[model samples]
Target: MAKGYKQMLAEADALVVSVTAEEMAGKLEDDSIVLVDIRDPRELEREGMIPGARHAPRGMLEFWIDPESPYHKPWFAEDKIYVFYCASGWRSLLATRVAQEMGLDAQNLRGGFSGWKKDGHPTAVKEKRRT
Candidate 1:
């Protein structure tokens, strides 16, 4: 027998905190909360992201968070609470779980960026990065 994506997602969801768009919006002004967007660049180009959110592609997350890793990002060591979001929350859920296991204060947005936009939340576009 083999486990599937749904089972993995369920397990991650059980362990990760899921915050609603409204809750996240309330925390926007909190200096201790850092909203993280984990979608790929193409997705971001197709859809805007939460304002002031930091972009950390899903692929580089673990490396960026590990202090011992040469790719470690200083922000990962900050005292802020990280709230991750993807297009529809799936990737973010798994990301939250992994981040927590790596000793981060992390949570996933319940409905992700799509839900946030649907709920009329504020969005911002990132400047294109040179390749």
Candidate 2:
């Protein structure tokens, strides 16, 4: 039987660092941290993202993270703490686990963008993606 979403989230949460919005806010001041937004384009358009976060759609995460892949983004090669977030924490937890497995230093923002907003962190409007 396939594992349920909650089980997967629990497993991922255990393996990946889950930081609170306040913690993430402090980390933003560090030059060695990269904030990655993994939410869909539509979601971003509807709700914005953490200021200065890189937009890496969830579907392309693996390709973008692999150095050997043609789709790899140069930013990923930099030695920085990758901090991923989505509309909520669920997607980020899983993504962080996957990135960790790929040998990347990664962590997820606890409660994701929603938590950020709830915690009163500033958000920036997302730029429209090129088609």
Candidate 3:
């Protein structure tokens, strides 16, 4: 944690808010949390995705979260919980930051997509050959 950021995290009621892939896997059947894939379409096409996770593309996440915006979807509401993941933890961290910034209850999967697979969760493989 960065010096000032750490202090802010403690002062702002913010928590570490992280969960491993295995924990998330067991929670998937629960309706209380929404799993989002923040990876680009190309990545999903190449590596497939987590079953039941929604694709919100990292690029347009904010747009989708804007309640009054034409792109707004039911998933953007702050009352809804979110678990975001990407090929690695970086993008998912960014996504979680965005969701938190928007006042949504969200957390990042520490190891992300790779971690999900490593934890023995079933992955949805797209029917295509990787180049």
Candidate 4:
């Protein structure tokens, strides 16, 4: 029997959750959340992070998010409230949805990093090396 393309695509997108950065900020301020930055190292190396956000990287998100995986400890704690983010927020949205599917209380940062920048939040610039 042949598989349906739509069914495959839908399955591909089945696990992801989403939220806005503004909503995240409010939650963070109240000490109610944990920020997970799932962007690649190159992007973060170029643009820096949102101060206290943990680096998980999209490539290994599923692995790291899994309690059975060794990479889980650094990112997960008991009852952790994770909020993943990316450059444009789409990635984070997809990620959070996946987390939700995985039975985790996760959300995505709206507008991703850009939302934070637009809100007058601080961002660190990678200093050019003068060799």
On lDDT, the candidate that comes out on top is 1
How far residue 114's Cα lies from its native spot in candidate 2, in Å, is: 0.4
- The residue-by-residue lDDT of candidate 2 on 1-131, one tens digit each, is 99999999998988888889998888777889999999999999989988888999999999999999999999998999999999888998999999999988998999999999999999999767788
- Assess candidate 4 and give its TM-score to the true structure: 0.74
Please provide, for model 3 over 9-85, each residue's C-alpha lDDT reduced to its tens digit, 9 standing for 90 to 100.
Answer: 34433453878887888888888888899988888888889888888989889889889778987767847679888
Off by over 4 Å in 3: 1-16, 126-131
Say which candidate scores most in TM-score: 1
Decoy 1 TM-score against native: 0.96
Clashing pairs in 1: none
In candidate 3, the residue pairs with backbone N, CA or C atoms under 3 Å apart (3 or more residues apart, or in different chains) clash, namely: none
Clash count, one per candidate = 0, 0, 0, 9
What's the true lDDT of residue 95 in model 3?
69
lDDT of 1 by residue, 32-119 (tens): 9999999998888778789989999999999999999999999999988999999999999999999999999999999999999999
Residues 1-131 of candidate 4 have per-residue lDDT tens digits of 78675554355345444566566666655455788888887788788778778778788888877888877755465477788888977777777877776777886677889888788776765444455
Which runs of model 1 end up more than 4 angstroms from their true locations?
none
- Provide TM-scores for the models: 0.96, 0.95, 0.80, 0.74
Ranking by lDDT: 1, 2, 3, 4
